[model samples]
Target: MTPRPFSGFEWLIAWRYLRARRSEGGVSVMTWISLIGIALAVFALIATLAVRSGFRSEFTGVILGANAHVTVYAQTYNDEFGRPTRAIRDFDGVAERLQAVEGVTRAAPMVRGQVMLAANGRNSGVEVFGQRPADVQTIPLLAEPERARGDIARLADGVAIGQGVARELNVGVGDKVTMISPNGVQGPFGTTPRISHFEVVYIFAVGRYDIDRTRLYMPLSEAQTFFNHQDTVDEIEVLVTRPDDVAAMIAPILDATGPDYFTWTWRDSSGGFLRALEMEDNIMFVILSILVLIATMNITSGLIMLVKNKGRDVGVLRTMGLSEGSILRVFFICGASIGVAGTIIGVVAGSLFAIYIDPVFGFVNWLLGGGVWDPSVRFLSALPAELRWEDVAKAVGLSLGLSFVVTIFPARRAARLDPVEALRYE
Candidate 1:
């Protein structure tokens, strides 16, 4: 008749009821449904997070490789307006000084100009970039693994054209192309539009249509002479050891430049894409979490039904002096057990699938005739999956929290059952 003694005994009986319910005819169906729901929901969430993270990581690499981590340009409203007015002196020494900065890995100067590329009477507007061969190869990580080539110093009057540009111009390596600049050269009579020709020594296909179609790279001297910039540059590109440190690294360089130039990071150049990815992640998390919540609600319903079916047992236990707290703990433990088992299964399934997603995508790509993850059309060259422990932990925590909270209603209802009414019920 002791209430305290009944606490331990009530839990023992509660556990038996929980285990016994699995064998009950209708209860097993509902239990399996609830378990499957939680497992599938958690699995989907984890897998989706991994793929999204992979996309961001790989695309960021492409951007970093194609451009510098940080760019220092003349501080006018725009580079075009400021190029003539601003003076960027000591550029050669600037690269060495920037290398001494804590985070900077390398620095280089580049001349940028807008010009028309003409070949065989076919013309396309392009952006020409001029860089010293040594500096060009040093800053951005541009290695043609497919070609097994080491450096791109072969780009003398040589040029690397994008796949799109090459197709449009019908040009290839060893072809001659002419660049006509709108910036005219000084003449005895007046300024005259200048035309310069360069031989394409090497070609690089970065898989970005906009970059490939509109970009052309050549030696720094040719670009300067062609653009009429005898001893000045359009911008300075700095590569950093850690991309995350780009903003912090800019402060000292900006101070060194003494406000004559403005520094920009890759994040600044590609803000729109980065923000889009962030928004997508948030949306996916919210949408997927709702599924787990819906599954938890199912668990709540199943537990409530079980409590009703076992009303007589609960009433008899109360009559035997079981405490409400003990009754509540029993039901809670039962529900939590279901959640834990489902979560374990889901975590295992999700991790395995995420780890193999890249290979799966590659296989799919081969099956689809090499078009599953087209770098030419899509930002990501292949399916990417990046598993983060933090994401997994968040999912587990969410599942557990939802599962525990859902048990409260059923647990409380069973604990508060009236023994007298329940004992009289047939």
Candidate 2:
């Protein structure tokens, strides 16, 4: 049996040191604090990254859902003459040509402009989009028939408002709202906004404030009449078969629409929101990584203190034929044990917290009594979490790697203990 292996004994001693109480010359208060700190740092980093990833995912889906993948706008959106000089005159033909383009799943004409919505003695600024309700492709993702309290089919004859708008105005389906177009007919009276009232045939919730709180749908003919633009359309909305292929699909779409038309993807028109999210995620990662780095340093300090406390043990072990290499191995096991345990627990706890985030927030809201994740104030009704294995892997790897690297200093110091000096004091 060769009296068993020295590695096994070293691990045995390390495990004992971790489990021993202060009365038995075991792990100190600082060691426990360091262990807990590292675990918390890992937890915070993992949960925060998950939150950021979830936001990006939610926002992207909302953007893609509420709007077309690509839009072929006239050369210039508007001209100084208060007229859309490049308005698509041949809307039907342009839509037909665009639909024939490769990668284009669907094409339809759309009109959008800012308007003031007044209902139930309340007024709110709103964005109006004119489209034929018969074309299901152009409707918002959350504006499905299941969620609507009124008839979505009436969009062409009446108006469809968002849930937020309905709430703010305290109006429901069958209510009438006045829509005043900002771009109205110019007259000698220095221009007056064109106002029209329509029955609120539908109320939608797009899960986005910009669209839900400020968006309305009307019939193309009504919009044309109100905006004083007839026999033409503002733009052509296009849906792509594959969202990722939007950039590639651009060339063919532009060619099909002719040089007179300008094509813009959803990403292009998101007002730099996509780039801002990426930048925010990067910045947050770096900031949280710094916190994690500080926590890892505690492992080194704890190991150093443990080595200083166990100097006499090293001498006795060396006298019993233990080598300096074995001494180093013992300390490595001690320090690495804490790191490994903390990392494992952190991963499990953090993952569970992130994955079940909805329930967690629900509990919080219940305890705090509202204001936890209000949809009116928050983009989502509950906190969103999208856990990425890559992020978890990076966090675990960094913690374990740093723990290993930190052990070298204290382990080397313990291994260098002079047996003679250590024994003379005893």
Candidate 3:
């Protein structure tokens, strides 16, 4: 009797053919090679994309921590003070309205101005900013356990500076410094610059060299008096619960401030630098996909060899009434099994490797002698990696699809064989 149509006999034969020794028509060597090649390709593809994502995440976190997720500025048409710079009037109401918006965690008014920071005899131009005592502590990643945390509320008459600024000025905690304002009041003598002496209270170690070099923080009330804005603020700094949600939060904030005021997110301030990095990542993903494609090509070659070696067996099976479809299923299973196994191995290996790549790279570096990455030139001390599950799924799907497609040609070739022609020399 003919065999049942949906029986698993074809799968059993396919698996047996795969396990057969080289002397028995199995391409055993090629099978191992295909498995190994696919694993390397998957590992490389996943690890490469993960490292790029990690770098992007690191940059975004550092930038957002140092800056507000969004900033709002008011453009005043008329200012009683002739200073070219304008201030947002009635900012307390604006701050309250902003705090009420959904997703906005905090909204604080700040005064920002250019001031000269003077040490013993040396002076450096710096940007001075003023925040409320409670507000000052909210700056992102502003403090680290490596450095001692101090109370900004106690800094009633003191200034907080970045480490780079302190180094450049040769100042330290408790060292006295003078801040000079260029926009001074007109006195009986002439235009006199406003000078104020302050004790250094806290030092912010914000990792980024640029932020550390030029930012000085003080109380908002003191900043208003120094900048001559008694009842106004330079701008409103806003922090959202999620940095990624800044784009959506901009509209509601603008509604609260009316048309004259404008809002900008971190994306707006970051400009092309961040956008360019994203483009680079896309390019890398495309480039790495080629490696996986090349690896899948090995599956085609191995499957083709198996078909050629199994020609005599195919003729015998056909002569015994095994249909063309059954013959095709057997070979299809053989090829697909290899592809699935390799893809699974790749996903598991790639994920583990990317997650701990820094340590792996460190070991490799040690083996090859130190200085593989120069700290002076590279911003990150270690390689950062972030594996995305979607990426793994994409890689696996492409590999399996290619494997199944390659099987069709070889299986179809075997199905079309004439029993007499295939078994003539058997």
Candidate 4:
């Protein structure tokens, strides 16, 4: 007898077989294993992506807050440490020209230099930053009142110190500190290091190990005189209307300043940290995604078991002229259904878990008699879950795609079954 071609009804048969199996056996051990694997893989992918996104977002925010969106430094502008100097002089209204560029929100010249901070007989290398009093507030990471002084511009020798620097030097408000610049003065000594004293008006803590302990803030005029860089700034720190447009804004600044100036965005400045974050997320996602792959394997096994049990039906269908493609589709549909269902469940489950990780951690912290805002162990006192939609989309897509891929071989095997051989056993 000529076998019949498989039709839509054959898919119904496949589904019915799956349903019957579930009703009678209520998910075989293999099915359970597959389900667990898919669930775990989905969970891990979502969680890893969320964490990576969160950490990156948090760190980026901190960095941008402390730094500018784009920094334009002198090309030859070397420090007093005997390097070729970069010129950052009046580019004939270059700051205004940059501010006119599309996506540019604010542009300001920043004076920065290296200086030795001396307090209470202890001295440390510090980066002295000079900024406009009003514009300083616009930068991302600065805490309110960190520059507690009324106006840095008016204060001749007033300065601000980081908490870490203060603690180490045992200096505080009303204390006097002397800053020695690497740039020397050519007076009677014919090239002696320029040193100046300033009164510490306020102390601020940003909590960053690098910035908090090694930064000092002073007026631009004081810094210029201290460094002997008259009418020139080390760089121009720009604030953009949108962070993503940092690169777009850079071109104009670079063009206006000419090639002699080095223009860079925050991404350029924080590339190492960003790369590390991406690597961590990728490693975690790969590790977690394995769970899904394993689950898909289980699904494959279960479908194979179904094919063996339903050999008689398959034989009958084959005798009825079901094509190999139709047979393959039937089994593929069955296996894929299992994977799809598990992936859906996992996506929802993992997202909820990530969203509430902080609250859960808080409860645990409370139970352990630890303050939620403790600044000792964890870099951040509270838990933060930064979920990006793109990450979620990627996780779900990978899960679905893997599930589909795992079904292919099993489906092919089912399609290739010989009707006579299958029926002989039945």
The most accurate candidate by lDDT is: 3
TM-score (C-alpha, index-matched) for candidate 3: 0.83
Candidate 4 global CA lDDT score:
0.74
Candidate lDDT (C-alpha), each:
0.77, 0.81, 0.82, 0.74
lDDT by residue for model 2 (240-359), tens: 988766889989998887888888898787749889999999999888888877887888887887777788888998898888888888888888887887788778888998999888
Model 1 misplacement above 4 A: 1-26, 75-84, 87-89, 118-124, 144-151, 167-197, 205-213, 319-322, 362-377
- lDDT by residue (360-423, candidate 4, tens digit) is 7778888988875544454443456777788889888888898888788878987888999988
TM-scores, one per candidate = 0.82, 0.90, 0.83, 0.72
Structure candidate 3, residue pairs in collision: none
lDDT of 1 at 406: 92
Candidate 4: worst 10 consecutive residues by lDDT?
145-154
Would you list the rank order by TM-score, best first? 2, 3, 1, 4
lDDT of 1 by residue, 186-214 (tens): 77988788988877776665545566567
Total clashes for model 1: 0
Winner of 2 and 3 under lDDT: 3
Candidate 1 lDDT score relative to the true structure: 0.77
Model 2, TM vs. native = 0.90
Worst 10 residues of 2 by lDDT: 137-146
What is the lDDT for 165 in model 2?
89
Compare the candidates by TM-score and give the number of the best one. Answer: 2
